[model samples]
Target: MTFSAVARSADGDSFGVAVASKFLAVGAAVPAAEAGVGALATQAFANLAYRPEGLSLMRSGIEAAATVNRLVTADAEAQTRQLGVVTASGPGATFTGEECLPWCGGVADDGYAIQGNILTGPEVVEAMQVAWLAGDPATSLARRLLAVLAAGDRAGGDRRGRQSAAVLVVRPGGGYGGTSDVEVDLRVDDDPAPVEGLERLLRLHELYFTRPDPATLLDLTGDLAAEVTERLSRLGHPGEPDAALAAWAGMENLEERLAPGRIDPVVLDLLRKA
Candidate 1:
């Protein structure tokens, strides 16, 4: 009832999973990752234990294929389960049990795995693999994963239909405020178009949580500064423009993009729309 991709960043600093399905809250069941360790997706009678246990194995120096072998070999229900695993190094691995519903299978390469069960056809997994291989390595792992998921979705995802989707990426100090390993974790628990919803949430996440690109910073000056001041005043923040902008950004959870003597284009656009 689901399709997923698990991958490590080209630089080996990140690991992530993106998945969508007709299942309710597929995110809660299918995807898990740990910074500097590995990632996995367990579905089709998914054994939730595979998540933590698989990461622990990878953390202990086990490669992805071996970790998968250990998990499935020990499970009595292995024939009904499907899993995908990828580590920071070594080849990725995917498994589709013989008893899984029709149109179930997977593919894996050195850095990624794509898998699905109860899917529309082999095309779903094939499209995802193509997207992953073609994605620019310079892009964030989260974005690349999402692109793969979207490709699978476009190619006809779960044979049942779409109900939920999620993307999870991890890297050391990659979470908000650098306090955690979760780089991006967004979910659409129940949506008619969950992949598209996930995409919108990712864009918002980048704007609010990521630091502003130095090259895109605009110095506060001339008409731009005057317009910013006017907008702040209208938003009931009539004060030094910079201070008011800071206060407003704090309220909107956009403080990460704040910089002295400059404005992020995203912030400026939000202020204009406000």
Candidate 2:
């Protein structure tokens, strides 16, 4: 019913699954990730059991292949199960039920699981892996995953066609009330440009939800702050130097911040760091 990839980074700091399908709630079902743990994507008559069970198997010191083997063995419909996994340990594995549609295959290596089923072709997953491996290791997993999804789209993804896409990545204490199990969870449902939409959301998360990178920090002092005030003055937020500087210096605090639109302050940060 879908093609999916579950993988970890070369540095093992992130683990994620990027999946696009003609399926609904793909994010809630197909993508399972835990920071400092493991990741998995189960599809093609997917067994939701794979989410928790697979992770449990991994935590118990099972390899991706063996974990998958255990899950499928217990499943009466193993012929219709397609699974891919990457462990926090940087191990990788995949399985495409012999009953899966054409262009179904996967590559598991280097802390990554790249796979797809009922796909445009094997090239989709291959291109995704190549794009990811070529990406900057220090880049956010969301960005790297977005790159792969874009590559998949370019490669003619989802033989049944695309309607939605989702990404899930997590870390310790990353969940809401420590129960949400997400560092980043974005879904684009029923969109003509789901991956692009997801990218926009990811950028927003980076700006507001995630910490500011050192390069993203800028001195909110001096003439640069003045420039920011002058620039934002016309944006209806009151262009007074103090207000603008305050906004730039994060006067409203990070809680009131909005993404990609905080260009004025970011310019100050850029200039300050330069």
Candidate 3:
């Protein structure tokens, strides 16, 4: 039993999926997406092939509905599978097979799709849709998807309870080292509170992967510089404040937050607190 959504960013630059299930490692089986193509989730006897095949079909210029229809129609156990699809710059589509368990269904709208099987009630999907549609378009897709997934969980989620949760978001040159599209791919495979665990991981992901806004950069100077120098010296750093700050950030794996010639405000705060 699972509840999931496949969505594209309002700016058409990102796509992702967020899912929660009473199944172990639901992310490994339920969700798939590519930067410029589309995203989908297959549950309720999920056909793993739908992942790559559905992406291929969408990449070939198929819209969400046509791609989902083709996949569902060709499946031998079509009546037992639940599916959702959303293209990078097109509409969304969802399918819930007749043979799926009770309270199984879905909703599809422009740029997003939500679906689930063996959920508490229609409210589970409704809460997700409402949260999703009400989100700020400027918010990151990963955060938006997580917001809806959290709402669905609050609305009773899968009747069988939670065991796993995951979120995957992608954009051009968004992955580690900027050579791939996987901006974020996180999973809480067996946590009692997987959504919360997932949220924590998302925070860490942002801290390590995203660059700080220029407006948020804090220049280490004067008293702050002197204080940083003192702290660095006490921590066994032996150099100017700026160089030592860079070394500390590198040691903490926070190089992404560094600016060309300034310290990050968050880094300053972290050093102060430490």
Candidate 4:
């Protein structure tokens, strides 16, 4: 009913999980991660406790394989669950219980784990592993995870069909305003194409919450300033262009991209489109 990948960034500073399934709101059940600790997905009669408990074990310096072993061993219904785990260092681990439905299995290697149960076939998890391995290390962990999930979807995901999808990524100072570890947490529950929906949400997340790249900052001056002022005036924000732009950005939830005496290309493009 589900397929997932859990991974640590190439630099080992980030960790994430991406999953999609025939289950409703699978995000709420399958994925979990903590910055500087580890990530895991528990499905097929998921034991929710495995989330926090697994993170704790990883934080205490337990390796990924050991953490999976400990969790399954302690559970009386171990044969009914599937799990994948990756920590800040070393190889990851994947587990598929003998009692899980047909087409259930997993694969793991350095820094990543891919797993699924009741999937279309072994190809689903295999495609995910290929995508994860081939993804550009320079890309954000969230995007890489999404690519893996999308690959699983393209390869034929849950045998029952798709209903939900989600991506979770974490890193130190990666959250909104650097206030938390959650770098990206987007979900598409009950969607006909949940992976596609999740991709759109991830774009919005990057635009709104991520700070502008310094190299792309455009100085607010001359014709650009005049055009901005005119645009703001037309939008009923008549004032100094910078001040009006600031006010508008706050309202639009784009304050994260604001910089003194400059505008992000994304903000300017949005203004023009508006």
TM-score of 1: 0.95
lDDT of each: 0.94, 0.74, 0.92, 0.94
Clashing pairs in 3: none
For candidate 2, what is the TM-score? 0.81
Model with the higher TM-score, candidate 1 or 4:
4
Candidate with top TM-score is 4
Question: What tens-digit string does per-residue lDDT give for candidate 2 at 74-171?
Answer: 98888788888988784688888888777788888867777788898878988888887898988777778888888987898888877788988766
TM-score result, candidate 3: 0.96
What lDDT tens digits, residue by residue, belong to model 1 across residues 9-52? Answer: 99999999999999899999999999989999999989999999
Pairs of residues clashing in candidate 1:
none
Give model 4's clash tally: 0
The list of candidate 2 runs beyond 4 A from truth reads 173-181, 224-274
Please list all clashing residue pairs in model 2, or write none if there are none: 3-117, 218-269, 233-239
Error of 4 at 166 (Å): 0.7
